[model samples]
Target chain A: NAGVTQTPKFRVLKTGQSMTLLCAQDMNHEYMYWYRQDPGMGLRLIHYSVGEGTTAKGEVPDGYNVSRLKKQNFLLGLESAAPSQTSVYFCASSYPGSQGKETQYFGPGTRLLVL
Target chain B: AQSVAQPEDQVNVAEGNPLTVKCTYSVSGNPYLFWYVQYPNRGLQFLLKYITGDNLVKGSYGFEAEFNKSQTSFHLKKPSALVSDSALYFCAVRDSSTPGYSSASKIIFGSGTRLSIRP
Candidate 1:
């Protein structure tokens, strides 16, 4: 099974452009997350969803929005891209159960370049 | 507030030698700590985690980490370093009972540790 898949592996956009990054997981996990990786910032959370129809803000949610319309899909939307938004974005999912098991599976990632 | 710090920007070790990447965390209550490794231009991969049960937790790729409550640290360790082990390492922490984690959870990651194994 495809653990996690992110669409638009690479993209280049001029400033003020709009785009959406899609993430899908087949594990039926209840938790999904979006993160961006910069040179020295490591990975910073952008947005996340617990399940279908549920979404929440994360550590760095200023320039993005998210939707979890489907249980297996999470979408990140950039209303207006900027040079600061040029970074590798990752999508991840996890299963949190009664046993306190928290293992996150990640997608390859989308590399975006905003000029 | 929860946060993580990987003091060393880069660590170099000879192959076959024991390797250690340091990490420290700050959080209220019990912290669920985690270690993840990333290859060049790749997503972070889970290595191990420390919850309530044990201070030393073992995970994939012969990697392990020790949890020290007194020092508020969870450092990643490997008995022997390998060329393939060279990668970017991250430390993360979260409070299991934090209000922000009631639904979809978010984690704080350390700056990152670049481990290089010299032949």
Candidate 2:
């Protein structure tokens, strides 16, 4: 079913460069999320959307912006990439309700390196 | 605010031996706990969850976790560890109170513990 897929599985960007990471899911889930995993820091939420048109800030959303223009897609954009933003990004989706009570399916993840 | 803690940074065990990964949580109301496993360079995989039921929750790969409400802990356990079980494990929690649904919708994850089962 291709539960979740991420585009540009690996990318390298120069300082000040901009790029977008795309996430798509065919599960028809109502909730989508963006998270970054770093060494010793674990996984920190970047942004999330409850529905097609609603987006909310997560634990660490400073250097990123997200758009949920379509139900099956969620996009994360970095206006200007920095070394601090280099990390493995993961996209997840789940059914509606309290997040802890539901199962979140995650994508393969994109490895971004900003030099 | 809801939070999760995995006290151990790494856990080592021999194959065929019992293993345990500790986890503790804090939330305003009732807490929904979860466990996820991640392999090298891969996304997190859902292992199991505790919503409302028996304290002993069994999950995939013969893994189980015991929920202790009084101690506010949900420790993952396996009777016989396998070499393939070596990976990163995460503990997460969220509040179940209706009044805190907005904030509770967010799952707070712990720092994660690396499990190494030697052959």
Candidate 3:
């Protein structure tokens, strides 16, 4: 099973350009998340969707939007890319529960470079 | 609010020696703690987690972490260090009090710890 897969593993965008990063998971997880990893700052949540139709803002949701049209897919969109937004983006998914069983599985990552 | 911290930015251990990467956390309710390792340019890989039962949780690759409520720490440990074990480690935590039904779950991660196992 392709636990999690992200499209456009690498992308380069000029300032003000817009693009969308797609994430898909074969596992029937109820939770999907988008995160960006910076140099020393750990991964920060960009946005998240708990189910197929619900989305929520996360710690760093400012330059991005997310949609969960299908249970297996979560999309993160950048309306206007900026140099500050250049980072490695990750997509993850997990089961929904209060117990410790909800371990998030992550995709390789998408490297975005905004010039 | 829930937060996690990894005090050491870099940890160097000689091969065959025991290794410890420190992690501490603070949460409103019971802490759901986790450990993940990231290679050069790869995504974070789940190592282990502490839920409810055991204070010492063993995970993949012979790594383990001890959860101490009194100290608010969940330090990752390995009996013997190997060169292949060198990588970046992260500690994450979430508030267990958050309702399970809520779709908007959030987890806070520590900055990260770079572990180097030398020969």
TM-score of chain B of 3: 0.96
lDDT of residue A82 for candidate 3: 93
> Tens-digit lDDT track for model 1 on A21-85?
99999999988999999988888888888779989888789989999999999999999999999
Native contacts, share recovered per candidate: 0.57, 0.54, 0.54
Please, what are the lDDT tens digits per residue for candidate 3 over residues B23-90? Answer: 99998888889999999878899999988997999999999999999999999999999999999999
Q: Judge candidate 3 against the unseen true structure and give its global Cα lDDT, from 0 to 1.
A: 0.91
Q: What's the residue-level lDDT of B105 in candidate 3?
A: 56
State every prediction's TM-score relative to the real structure: 0.95, 0.96, 0.96
- The two-chain DockQ for each candidate, comma-separated, is 0.58, 0.61, 0.60
Q: Tell me, by lDDT, which candidate is best.
A: 2
Runs with alpha carbons beyond 4 Å of true place in candidate 2: A97-100, B98-105
RMSD (CA, Å), each prediction = 1.6, 1.4, 1.3
> What local distance difference test score does each model get?
0.89, 0.92, 0.91
lDDT of 3 at A7: 95
Clashing pairs in 1: none
Query: Which pairs, if any, clash in model 3?
Result: none
